[model samples]
Target: MAAFLEAVPARIRTLGAYQPGKSIRQAEQESGVSCIKLASNENPYGPSPLAVAAMQRELAGVNFYPDQDSLDLRAALATYAGVQPEQVLPTAGSSDLILLLLRLLLGPGSNAVGGDLSFFLYRIMTKSVGGTLKQVPMVNHAYDLDAIAAAIDHNTRVVLLANPNNPTGTLFTADEFERFLDKVPARVVVALDEAYSDYAEEFAVRRNVVWSRAFDYVRQGRNVLVLRTFSKAHGLAAVRCGWGAGPAELIGMLAKLRTLFSVSSVAQAAALAALGDLEHIHKSAIANAEGEAALSHALAEAGYPGVPTWGNFIFVETGEPALEVAAKLEKQGVIVRPMKAWGAPTAIRVSIGTSAQNELFLTAFRKVMPAH
Candidate 1:
């Protein structure tokens, strides 16, 4: 009989599964106390009221399949991006888009490039396609675009760039990107995953340049695709819908690869409705900004300085081992993410929660860290 481990591909067996943040249910079950979870960078404020109503309305047609091509959502996303619907492609989420793009762009002999301390799913997705993953190390805990561009070779098919990058939450500037774009060839695809773009702060100094305009490069016919999710600012994480905005030709090819009716009717309906409630998103941003500032300040006062963040999560260096700190905190009714899988055993990622949640987390963190 064939052994189960032997049946799996070498790369698949070698790759670690994606480690999600600890669930609140799991924590409460393990601990005697009710837990406040600040692990997953989820919106502590729930989904838009309009989106909830839309989702409830969709329950009436639960038996019907979603539009295979997500036409309505595409049109909505296109309007937001100032592009044609043909240039937009919706997926189950940004992760789904990443998975689909990995399949479409990679094969046995190609390579994908991204940062070492980035959304690690890109590495797994690239490896699953039998492609080499070139993880360029960050400079000063931020993306070194120059190093990333220099890492690309002839066989490099895709470059995964996360704006306001995950874990570390560092964002590259428009001028920095413009310079980097000059080095990249038009043939190679650059995927800009902007899932955390909702939490990005607008600097009046820049006057309008906040999020990465990688999608605009796509509109200009560059080989770029900007990925966004309803999961973040729209607070529709459970709905599981995201999109890729790119050149029409690439989007057309990607559409051929999209799973038919993979997006649920509820997700589609909710995402469409979420787009209209711009004020909810603004409120979310304000709350997130306040939470992040408070948490960072608190962590600094405890002598555990955090990385400079543009996203809602704060990655702080724990004086002790990260997993150990997290375990202790979990027992004390607070939950944060341990970053051992990302190769940083000294860091714990704490998401910006609601005002009360943040206070609870801070209280628990101080209580546990001192005693641990």
Candidate 2:
């Protein structure tokens, strides 16, 4: 068994596991206070009422296996995205879809390009499939699409762009995205991850969905794959439903490689119902917008400045060790993600929470970081 396991490729042996934000349960066990987790950027408002009802309805059918094709959910998503059913493939979550894309496109000798400050999962997934990974440094906390395109080489097969990027909570403009797409070679696939796209607001414009532009580009023969999640907007993170949209052929190939019953029956029903709950989505958006402002103002008052966020989180530079600050915050029952993992040592990313939770974290932060 040892010899067999050791036969694994050197690249696989050297891989580091992806680090997700610590759970509230872990924080509660450590801090002794029921933790107010502002980590992971999950929807604080939770799943829509309709989604809960749908899940409850499916509870009696737990013994039945889920649909291997997730046909109903895919059809519902196609309706929501205004794309053909063939263009959409629903997975357990967007993360699974991303992994499937990498697996389908990447292999030994092929390289992948991704923003250094974007979702860390992109790097992990690309490397896991033996793809050489190139990291493009972000400009002003936003994904530098030019840098990403420039890094692409002949061997590059995929480019992963996480919009409204995690940890940093920044985004690329439409013009910049178009320029990047134009520069990318036809042989390579461009994956646009819109996990938090629902919360993204345009510069000087109101918040609205922008994924249609991505899909339109794909429809025009571009090798673009767009990913979205029910996690953030629909508050179905626990349910784990997400999908990808692109050419039918590309989606078909990915679908073939995906495991059977990737999404549970309950999850599919919950996602379908959540898609129709426009009111809940609106409430979550409003909560996130207000929470972002509140957190930013609180950070400023505490003498730490925060990055402008279009998602349900803010990245703030604390002028101190992020790990230490995070530890301090954790002790106070406010769990946040430190940016050290992303090589931003002086920054800590805080997920926007309810007003009460925000005030609690602010008070705790002030106490831990009193004026010298």
Candidate 3:
């Protein structure tokens, strides 16, 4: 073990592995019962029929290598995002793009700024490249944009942000984001993770939250990278496809650093098909909005009110040890994510599931949680 440690970089040795949420099979194995998984913020409804068909058609061509540049898919995505094809870079997923950005921009002396409780990957990715992650404390369970801007300095290479931030599911508006960007130096690249942007847009009409202008920033020649994924509303998580839009020059740099043929043929095909299926996307978003409302209301009535979420998940303060609550719910055939890893020991993040799944979770929660 000492030899192995010596072989690895000191920075790499200090990092811990990412802990993903519990799977349905794992939950069932632990609980000895069938379980509904609401731990990962996946779309309850599955992928579009068109996307599935596209994957099926590409199966025979798996013997051949995928397009190295992902040209066709990039064109489709560019059109969808209202940007030039050169401005977009597709990858295996948004996480892949994050690593690529860090590899390209970070080094020993540089650092990245982000909310303390935002996406966990920001810290891991930064540290992996021997860079510091300056985490600014959040305000009211949301990103403190001003504090984050203040944290940036000469050595700051990146500013990482997640819309509908993970764990908390809170966001800042477009005006706020623009003001924050004004304070950022031109050399610092702002990597905006918009994995949950679709859901945020769906809820925006009712909630009055202005969606981000990251893409607009790209068009205006800002050093901003807008990362998005098909894993959520598109229901293409298994396909592992996502894209980043930025200035053409920045996109070129990321493309050069991207692993060769990182996105498989199956993933590219499914993502291409999913891009055109706006109806399915819209339906999924509407269903998620409905589910969020229902679940939030139910939890509130049960004396565990959840934070207003723009993502397809609700962050609830359980007023109990979150891991204990999660374990009890798992035993009752419901699986949720405890926020202990994110430093909120009394909170759990519950993905908004189908109405029936939500009902099952509520029933299980009632059985496990003591009444107020």
Candidate of highest lDDT:
3
Tens-place lDDT per residue, model 1, 25-76, is 9899988789988888888889999999999998989888878877788888
- Steric clash pairs (candidate 1): none
lDDT of 2 by residue, 247-309 (tens): 899999999998888799999999999999989988888778888878888788778878888
lDDT per prediction?
0.85, 0.85, 0.91
Give the CA lDDT, 0 to 100, for residue 287 in model 1.
80
Candidate 1 lDDT (Cα, whole model)?
Answer: 0.85
TM-score of each: 0.95, 0.95, 0.98
What total of clashing residue pairs does each candidate reach? 0, 0, 0
Residue 11, candidate 3: Cα error in Å is: 2.3
Which candidate tops TM-score?
A: 3
What's the lDDT for residue 312 in model 3? 95
Could you tell me the TM-score of candidate 2?
0.95
Cα lDDT tens digits for candidate 3, 1-372: 777578888889778887788999988999999999999899889998899999999999999999999999999998888899999999999999999999999989999999888777788899999899999998889999988998999999999999879979998889988998999999999999999988999999777767787788988989899999999999998889999999899889989998899999999999999988989999999999999989999999998889989999999989899999999999999999998887789889999999999999999998999886
